[model samples]
Target: MSGVKMNNVIKQYGEIQVIHGIDLQIKDGEFCVFVGPSGCGKSTLLRMVAGLEETTSGQMTIGTRDVTTMDPSERGVAMVFQTYALYPHMTVKENMGFGLKMNGHPKSAIEAKVAEASGILKLDEYLDRKPAALSGGQRQRVSIGRAIVRGPEVFLFDEPLSNLDAELRVEMRVEIARLHKEIGATMIYVTHDQVEAMTLADKIVVLRLGRIEQVGSPLDLYRDPDNKFVAGFIGSPAMNFLDATSGEDGVTIQALKMTAPNPIGKTSKAVTAGLRPEHLEIDPAGDALRVDLVETLGGVSFAYLVSDTGEKIVIEERGDEPVSEGQRVGLKFDAKRLYLFDAETEQRLRA
Candidate 1:
């Protein structure tokens, strides 16, 4: 197993630079996830580490070796792509052993390695089945088994579950997490879904536009986001941001018609107040906002509310009180739970 390191890594195509200088560290045997919106260069960054994309500058190291310019095959890393990339006519066993066969390994060695990987992924029964005869999840498992046969020092997954349905995605997430633990190998996964990152990562790197916005554990980034972008990007319902102005009394929220703590200490400066859906409490006595929609998913529910200024907010409902669409309600929360960001810089106002 090996840790991966990037020192001021950069990538560009001609004159148009896509990935800015990025410095990251993925510790040995750690599950690190790179998450961001589309076109944010998460995939590009992963490819660079795989040696599929050229690094215009800076250094990349795997373990203690400088693999900055090494070929993908020589980097001691195995990649499982979004697409299954399975051979349509090959049996699962054959496909998983194909890489070793291509490398001129003995036939018996290939079969032994394939069997071991199949057992680990629980694909023993499907070993004789071709890609066409397998379900999406099974096919993906075979694809993963192919990587496992390589026994690479690091494993890389590039949105490997995007093709699966929601149920299969969840199932595969558990399988992948289990695979990481069973193998205890270094793994770097890339995804646009924050939910996957939250559930799978030991450490997460949040990217935006070609640069990293923040990097930390899932809960750290959720509870103590450094800026508005991170706060809005991490949570499922996302954080609600309302425009406001700082004053002597505090920060006055314009959309919700309320006041918040002024942690900025910059009076008269424009700011945005952030509140998470789960943290908000409904004040039925003060009808300042109107519920636009209600979504109940078994044990939890969410009330979508709209303010006079047309700003929307999602409030989580897990209590006994029932909130229906079109009902009028008010929002309240503790001052300590509120997050304030400078409107101009979009940075958190640390007190």
Candidate 2:
């Protein structure tokens, strides 16, 4: 296992700059995820680390070796791509050990490595089966097993679960998590899915428009984001934002027709107040919210509402009975849970 370091890494196509002076460090044996929306340069950055994309400028290191200009095969990194590129003609065992065989590894060594990888992935039963005979999840496992047999210093996964169905994605997530724990390898994963980032990452690098927005543990970014974008992107259903005018004691939200205490003390400026879906509660005496829709997902429900200001909000509800559309329900939240951001800068207002 090895750590990765990027010092002022920059990538450009002709005169158009995409990645701009990115600096980051991934520790050895850490499960670090690069998460962002499409065209955010997450995949481009990962490709640079894998030696597949040439770094336009800056230095990159895998462990202590400078691999900025190294060949892909000499970078000591194994990449598992979104597509399962297993050979249809080869059996699972042969597919997993193909790299070793191509590299002139002895037949006995290839068999031993394949066996070890299959044991770790629980693919011993399917070793004799070809890629055509395996399910989607099984084929992906074979792809991962192929990477494991190489014993590279770092593992790079570029949306490895995008091809699987929703249920199989969850199952494969558990499998990958278990594999990381058991192997304790340094893994770098890239995905646009925040749910996958929150669940599978030890540390998440949130990127926007080729620059890093934030990097921290999933819960830290969710609970204490540095900006409104990070707050909105880190959580499910996203954080609700409403325009407010700062007052001496607090801010007045015209939409909810309520005054919330301004803990940050930055008054006299236009601000935006944010509330997570799970934080809002339905209270009879609180500000009125007109329910527009309700989504019931088994035990928990989400009530979509529009406040008087025409701002949309979603509130998580838990109970047998849920608020229906057209119902006017009062909404309340803890003062501590409310997030205040500068309307112009979109940065969090701190006390």
- Supply the global lDDT for candidate 1: 0.93
> Could you give candidate 1's per-residue lDDT for residues 181-274 as a string of tens digits?
9999999999999999999999999999889999999999999999999999999899999888887788898877888776656667788899
Query: Clashing pairs in model 2?
Result: none
Per residue, candidate 2 scores C-alpha lDDT tens digits across 77-104 of 9999999999999999999999999999
Please list the C-alpha lDDT of all candidates, in the order they appear.
0.93, 0.94
When summed lDDT is taken over every stretch of 10 residues in candidate 2, the lowest stretch is 280-289
- What candidate 2 gets wrong by more than 4 Å, as runs, is none
